[model samples]
Target: MSTERFVIIGNGPAANEAATTLRQRAPQSGITVFGKETTRSYKPHLLPDVVAGRLDAEKIFASPEDYYNERDIQLRLGQKVVQVDFNKYQVILEHREVVSFDGLIIATGGKPRIPEPLEVFEDVMMTLKTTEDARLWIDRLARVDSVLMIGGDLTSLSLTRALINIGKKVFFIIDAESFWPLPFNERLHQEIHARLREKGVDVSSSRKIKRLTQLSDCSIQVETDCADFEVGIVGAFFGLVPDVRFLARSGLDIDRGILVDENLQTRFRNVFAAGDCAQVYNPVIRDYWVSIGYDNARTLGRIAALNMLGGMIAAQASPESIFSLNGVQVNTSWWMEF
Candidate 1:
């Protein structure tokens, strides 16, 4: 008899949780994790701290590189998986490297959703998701006096606060009529908006940024429904979508994200998914939405690992209520802007 091989994509929290769980259950399993970024697994939430210069890039990783080596887990970084040959039970990398597995887990997570209006000015635009993203824009962030950000979610607010912390003015533009994106009570929504405004954030709603023009010096001229404004840089928190383009033709069940059952198993038996990439059933929404909390990702990863090993553990971390606004509002009180 041969030991099983487990393969996971995206070395973020979800992937780490899944790998740790797999190691505990299947000790002899050949566990391998693939990360698109070269850095080791880190908490995505702390990227804002890094951008704000409060945390160092090296300190953000949840585990050091040697941890994986000590645990007998393989880490394949800097390789982007582009295709999956389900029949062959293998993942094909961008450069045509193949990784075969007996059980496959897709923890690929989400990518920054850059709006079309900001696409042309990509050089001047930023989406703070990865360590590399924060490092790339950190120097530019220092030279900027004011920053323009689009969206009214938690991630948006976190990034806004980070910019404000660095002595840079922040313009938080909410494209919708109301500032809140989630279906929270009107009182809470107003409360959050008020708090942001109180912090000296130039918060605006009901205006959509239509286009962005990058000047020679890398500043941005943004034209919106309300008016045109020039700013040092422009960013959008339109939220994240599953990085599942590689599976577009793979015939996987995908709606908003990779659809998984209670055990986080996809339509295919040998393949499962979790975290931002997996849209598990949300009892609150009555439909599957991406589970964004740390607990939710951890629970999903554990459940996915068990199911991968023929165990039937049900997922319990999908929130039953929408108390906080996109899980970003609660942290607003932790930091002071200006």
Candidate 2:
């Protein structure tokens, strides 16, 4: 076997799993993980549970520092990849250091999409992407009397429940016609709506926020299509786009995410992307999009590692899943077709 080094640029579950798999498959291959966060990769999808006080932050981590140490993979936390050079297969970090990799995997997760113009007032809102974001909300929750949450996704609904549990008045604004547009049907939406309202959350559907105005007192006035509502804080969890800026300039075919073939190979023969960042041809959906859940990330990571090690495996279909909150428990499970 060749002693080629593999580099993973991300701090999320995808990056962690891929690194672990690479170590197991190619013991001699030097594996290094570069993350923009301070802590080991944690499950970001469970950030709401952490905010809701249902889960401890430490328990949300897929693996700990000792786990990585046991695998002999180098860990570089709290580091951001500023730019990349595909021609040279090198990456530039915020610290002005250049790292080169023989095999590269871009597992960088998406950033929270704050609407245009409103992004100028970042202090009035928070986006839940990393542990820092979750911790910030935990500290702010006590100071805020009311929360204006924007989005109808599962994460937003869970955050609404958490805010209401803490006795903070909650107003949910959704631009969609229904809650959780893809996974839930009308019946399921009504069921969820009833449950949320019973918990004292005000749910507003088919509403769009025009702009966010910060008052002199630091309260936020959310101007919507229907009317204006004032609250102490605003949280948005619409969804995530693929984190592909580094790969964008690499000449790799990118659609929703970095495009890879059935073998998980990018246009560059030595590079492969997996997890939520890699868009592979889906047999069921008949298109490539970043796989959205943790299980998909795990499978894709293993697949990528195997492909990188020059192994052949059958491609499997991607599954659909949904996240739901049952009281204090956050249940994220596979969504089966009836």
Candidate 3:
């Protein structure tokens, strides 16, 4: 018998979990994980801490170096898969390196949305999606006394709170009247808003940002339909859309994301997708969503690995509930916004 070769293209929770499960399911198999980001796989919730300097990049790894070494897994960091040869079972990386695999997992995850107004100030405004993004924000913290956040998703809210805790005044603007569009009791959502307000977040809902202008002090002044607000830093967290732009040439099923079955396997039998890059339908609850958060990603990744090994375990869908401000809620995940 010959050992199987597995390749996972991503560094988030899904890619990490899939590689780990593959190692456990087939001890003799060679597992490789390729990540576009150079940083280790850390919890998304810890990104705010990374930006605030509360946790270093090395300390925030969800699956640190030891985990990979203990499982005899290979880590390929800072490598982007430019193309996939479905006919040959090979992937071409940005540097023109070609790697072959028997099974592949596409856990490319999602990218943050940038508003049209902020596009011109590419050097000024920022989005928090990777450790590199956090590093950029952290580098400017010395000159940033306040932050203007322009979304109400989990990423935006968490960064707002983290900045506030670090003594940076935060001004938040959202399209909706409430906070995250989770299944929160209206009262709970109001309570969450009140708590954020008490903690010094200047939140403005139902507002539209027209454009961004540079003030005399090099700070960013947001021009909205209602009024103008100036801040030393500007960040937007309009949540994420699947990073499936690269898969267009692959000819796989893609609508909102790479469509996958209950087993997390894609149309191509050897190729699977998980994490924010996958849109799955759960037969148990008869619900469909673009999976977000770490827990759901892990579940799909594990299920993908099992299905690859001819196991019959189905991907379990994590329930979407009200996201808590104090980090006490479970089954919490965010869907598409705008």
Candidate 4:
């Protein structure tokens, strides 16, 4: 039996896929998955459905309760990896627990990017990045009749539709800057505004947010250059940034994310990064690109695992660029097949 110990840092699609692939290829390998979230991996795309009351919260889980146990995978939930010691081949948990590994797969995923103007008021800003965030929105929505959404993305669009479908008033400030990496042309921006207006959304053209004031009734007052509005909550959906703060000192080539070769292997051959947290090299472009979405994450995870096992399989470029949104073609990296 091979005694190779593998460490995967994440509990999302990429992390789970890597673990499964590793277990299959190396049956006797010691595999441990560290998830910051207490819950198991779940479909983040289905979160809007849960918030809209269309799907049950329990149905979001991507795997069965005993999936890891059946596969003999060590699953450590709620343990945030604070740092990685590449030289020592060790990972330090938040509580300073150190675990050594022969192979390491980093699939830390992305975190919600809060707009610069609203950074100070992040405490009151609602974001839908995980199941927990969705549950919080669901609970908060029950008490309010209207919501103010700042910024726009595929997730934001879906959540807006969900909110409207549930008979809640939505005031949207369409920020083109939120759709980074996605070509947000003026024509497309205007089209989004038109579509949102057609869907009964109070679409505001203003992009500048002056201030946010918390009201005594547990509501928020948004002051924009165009108008002032008060709502139960302010949702920020400015896309995502790599959640690689923990690896800041790991000495991995870091741009917006950890840079990896076409084989998903870092400069250190034993280390690999995949999913949203990895900026992979695109041979065609001769540049690095960060691929998002569930499909891309799963594909990259599998490729990363294969390369970790001494296979030289290059990752393909993400094929998800444009998706139809209610008859409108929207360009985004966050598109899900579902």
Question: For each candidate, what is the lDDT?
Answer: 0.76, 0.72, 0.76, 0.86
Candidate 2 lDDT for residue 308: 82
Top-down TM-score ranking = 4, 1, 3, 2
**Model 2 alpha-carbon drift over 4 Å, by segment:** 115-123, 177-191, 216-218, 283-286, 318-338
Per-residue C-alpha lDDT of model 3 across residues 1-338, encoded as one tens digit per residue: 02889999998998999988889879999999999888778887688888877887778788656889888899888899988988889999999999999999999988876656556766567888887888878887778688887766677767777798799888877644223324345574565567668888887766787878767443887888899878888787765778988889887888777888777788887788888788776675454456767777888788888788887777664454423322322233544321
RMSD of model 4 against the true structure:
3.7
lDDT (tens digit, per residue) of candidate 4 on 1-338: 25799999999999999999999999999999999999999989889999999999999999999999999999999999999998899999999999999999999989999866679989888899888898899989989999988888778888999999999999988887776545677897888888899999998866588888989455888887777878998899888788998788788999888899989999886899999899887676667777778888898899999889989999876435533322222223454321
- Predicted structure 2, TM vs. truth: 0.86
- What is the per-residue lDDT of model 1 for residues 186-281, given as tens digits with 9 covering 90 to 100? 675577668779889888766776777877454788888889989987876776667888898887888767888767888887799988788776
Q: In model 1, state the lDDT of residue 241.
A: 65
Candidate 4 wrong stretches, greater than 4 Å:
318-338
Model 4 clashing residue pairs (backbone): none
Predicted structure with the largest lDDT when compared to the true one: 4
Candidate 3 Cα outliers beyond 4 Å, as residue runs: 115-123, 177-192, 214-218, 284-287, 318-338
Supply the TM-score for candidate 3: 0.87
Please, what's the RMSD in Å of model 2?
Answer: 5.1
